[model samples]
Target: MASKLTMTPGEILREGELEKRSDSLFQLWKKKRGVLTDDSLRLFSGTSERAKELRFHSILKVDCVEHTRKYVYFTIVTTDFKEIDFRCTGESCWNASITLALIDYQNRRAVEGFRRHRFQRAASEAEEEPESPEQRALSP
Candidate 1:
């Protein structure tokens, strides 16, 4: 399988076979090897040379549609509102894995964004604020 698809970088949170619903008129369920990473979910089908990646930044949410005795059905909703359906064995817990990874990625991005904005605001404020008269005199 490694020869069929190149492995993506990052920690592998989980990896297993997943059934994905095709977008064709029949909407047939096809089995594919799924690799869950910190930053993306990579799906490899058949002998394809490349894996289709669903990056964390582009993902909006994961909706658990239903859970049967044998399988757990779920949907991955993207930022553009496209929903990709998938199902895995009940014990596989692919949905939970993907959801957790997505949440972690989003939280990290939010914190980084907040820090950048706060630093920029502080710098602007410091430049705009007037120095005290005594401090100004001491600066020569």
Candidate 2:
């Protein structure tokens, strides 16, 4: 059986904490599985007058839904306090070029924590195992 990957919102936010503001914002985009559209790019890149106008009140919205493939798909919504379709993708698509850049840093950290927990559990189990003389001989 495959183990489940679980994480919390606090953990997700913390991962992106060290990134530059723009990159962090981009990661938020990925976390939500948002595809960057022309408008979104303009705003995110600070390239347009409209972008400048709304920059102050702009916010990223992200939603993650559990999918049938045992992975979560994130939906990203961006707004100048108004809804905008910036970027979008489906759950099973593994296009890392786009996905990796958008991943919320906090989510990455949460994943790392989960990995560490699994590793520690395995190590503890190994330490708890009883060893026979033959097993000890083989351990070397």
Candidate 3:
């Protein structure tokens, strides 16, 4: 069955609580590690600065999930900004480089997902085609 609830970039952005939700999400990402400290803000600030410059703050939709090995994956969608997909797997909050890397990775994942979904639709259409008359003639 086709999903009635289709999410659009515009709709996600128009939501009133996006910024609050985004801040909350960042907090959750930090809380998941069970330690809240200045180091976390430092790491977040650096990452967010780069993201802001890259326009990630204009993001429309953001999704995050915890992977099997204590890693958290983040997916984000934006207007002029490209989609980001990344995973964080550092025990120490002081690892700013790793945090930045994960952010970049997540951005890549969002772009990849867009490409993947398009390819999947095309593949599904190709697979359901009826046999052509030309092919039947050639076979005989």
Candidate 4:
């Protein structure tokens, strides 16, 4: 792995062997060593060559979970409908980690968004309503 790939900022969870599913004649499912972080997954063909990246926030869905006697396979679907496949040795935690990380990221975003919306709504409501005498006197 190159320093460039390792420099991505996030809580690095798993970094080892993961294979991308390829269907083309020239490309087949070949195993590659890459880095998986809380915010993104990055793969490289060579140490200095960047191949692909799947960022958690931009991901729209995760699908295609298939298990065999040897490995666990899954796909990370992006917002643009790009499906990137990944697999780890049998009974490994790679798939689970990816799913959980993405879910956690989404849940955090939802919480922040809801809080922001509520805060704005409260501010507007306060501006539209007159302060009661009790509140006014309590203020000063």
Candidate 5:
């Protein structure tokens, strides 16, 4: 049986607490360590077996709000309208880290998608092109 703890193949980037931030107030919920890779965020719960994942390609936007030297609040908005929120402990830059990671992931995905699309279009054009008369005349 496959374990539910299985994570996608990649290096872990950053990890920290999952918190709720309201204006000047900051509250820490479960200490969720976020593993950021080129494609996703895998959050392993510190107090439970629960895990949450957010894929960069599926994320429509990341909204980050910085408050006075104490905290940085951020939200991950997915294409499916799911909004996940988190906050950084005092002076910690978890929000910036997550935002940068997401941006890098998204850019990489976009480049790869563009390359694939270009390659496919080129291949399709080659296939659909009519053979030249000179080449046809030389065929057996």
Candidate 6:
């Protein structure tokens, strides 16, 4: 039987170009190619070929700062409270895609936690319960 809990963590959800705001004094917007997977967002630099990966576990939330006729501005808040700014074409739904993927990843983690807790509780209960006569006979 197929398992509903099965999930591929590295599955690609979305891919596109984005404009990431730099940390320099001028805060120039630099173009980057983004690959959104089930567990992380990988941003590749256009000039340096370097990649910056932001895992879903570290991302706290995605905030939409503004929406203009030309672009959509958003911020990615990390677990440490650091914010990363980004913008993309008005028609490209990068922010929504990232938010949905992050939510899915978070939900998966929550389900796993519940499953683990339930399994542990069941095992403990079994250990504390008295064994049946048939079960005792089978034991070494």
Worst 10 residues of 4 by lDDT: 1-10
Task: Score residue 75 of candidate 2 by CA lDDT.
Answer: 40
**Clash count, one per candidate:** 0, 14, 7, 0, 0, 0
9-120: candidate 2 lDDT, tens digit per residue: 2222111101011244454532222223212222223222332221211435444433444443434444543443222233334322223323443354568899999999
Candidate 5, 1-140: lDDT as tens digits: 11225744466666666564333345435456766765777787666667677778788887875566766667878899877777767577776777777777777678989999999999999999997999899999
CA shift at 33, candidate 2, in angstroms?
26
lDDT of 1 by residue, 1-140 (tens): 12113545586877889999999999999999998887899999987869999999899999999999999999999999999999999999999989988887898799999999999999999999998998899996
**RMSD of each candidate?**
5.6, 15.0, 14.3, 5.9, 6.8, 4.0
* Model 4 lDDT tens row, 2-121: 233455557677777778777687657877767777677778765656657778888987775888989888888888887777788876667777777778678778999999999999
Q: Order candidates by TM-score, high to low.
A: 1, 6, 4, 5, 3, 2
- What tens digits encode model 3's per-residue C-alpha lDDT throughout 1-140? 11215632222111010111135455432322111221111112322333222233354545554444655465555556655544455342222433443354456667889999999999999999988999778885
Q: Name the regions of candidate 2 deviating beyond 4 angstroms.
A: 1-103, 133-140
Instruction: Choose 1 or 6, whichever is better by TM-score.
Output: 1
Model 2: residue 87 alpha-carbon error in angstroms:
20
Better of 3 and 5 by lDDT: 5
Candidate 1 RMSD to the real structure: 5.6
Candidates in order, TM-scores: namely 0.87, 0.26, 0.27, 0.77, 0.73, 0.86
Worst 10 residues of 5 by lDDT: 1-10
Better of 3 and 5 by TM-score: 5
Q: Is candidate 1 or candidate 4 better by lDDT?
A: 1
Query: For candidate 2, what is the total of clashing residue pairs?
Result: 14
Give the CA lDDT, 0 to 100, for residue 107 in model 4.
79
